[model samples]
Target: MTDSGAVLPWLVIREDDNGNRYRVGRYATRTEAEQVADRLGARAHERLYVVERVDRATA
Candidate 1:
């Protein structure tokens, strides 16, 4: 933590059966990320996650 005090962007990702993380997409808002996560979860047979991605702006 570099004390940037910035809100990072969100990402929607899927962890397949092979334990590989694949980015479904990136969103500017958490709501958008969660929406995509819901859609993917419905069809996903493996793990799905909505997580914050460290933005370059903060770096």
Candidate 2:
């Protein structure tokens, strides 16, 4: 759960050295790449959004 009181969807965002970007969505697992995708979808561009999950960190 996130601070917003909603189930926090783990997401990712990536930026190429050239400044190109893309978004992949609704993954059952989370990763840095997935979070990058979500961030890109949310902020860098106006497009259809999707939800994904991040891997639970293991201690």
Candidate 3:
């Protein structure tokens, strides 16, 4: 987050079998977020991880 409290553009989200979602982290680029997500996803047995871009206009 910035001083203005703006959220990062890239998000790493984790979802569990129960359909609960959590924000793993935020990044300035999608690639960075995806790398983190992929790393986490590899060790997850029943969970899911995804990377999404947060568009400021729609946010």
What are the lDDT scores of the predictions, listed in order? Answer: 0.71, 0.47, 0.89
Clashes of each: 0, 13, 0
Sort the candidates on lDDT, descending order: 3, 1, 2
TM-score for each candidate, following the candidate numbering: 0.64, 0.26, 0.81
| Better structure of 2 and 3 per TM-score | 3
TM-score of 2: 0.26
Off by over 4 Å in 1: 1-8, 57-59
lDDT of 3: 0.89
Stretches of candidate 3 off by over 4 Å are 4-7, 57-59
TM-score of 1: 0.64
1 or 3, greater by TM-score? 3
Give one digit per residue, the lDDT tens place, for model 3 in 1-59.
66779668999999999999998988888888989999999999999999988778865
- Write the number of the candidate with greater lDDT, choosing between 1 and 2: 1
The sequence of per-residue lDDT tens digits that candidate 1 reaches over residues 1-59 is 32466443677778877778877776767887888899879876767665657567663
Local lDDT at 11 for model 2:
47
lDDT for each residue of candidate 2 in 14-54, tens digit (9 for 90 to 100)? 44556654444333345644565556657654353444454
* TM-score order of candidates, top first: 3, 1, 2
Please give the distance, in angstroms, between residue 13's alpha carbon in candidate 2 and its true position after superposition.
1.0
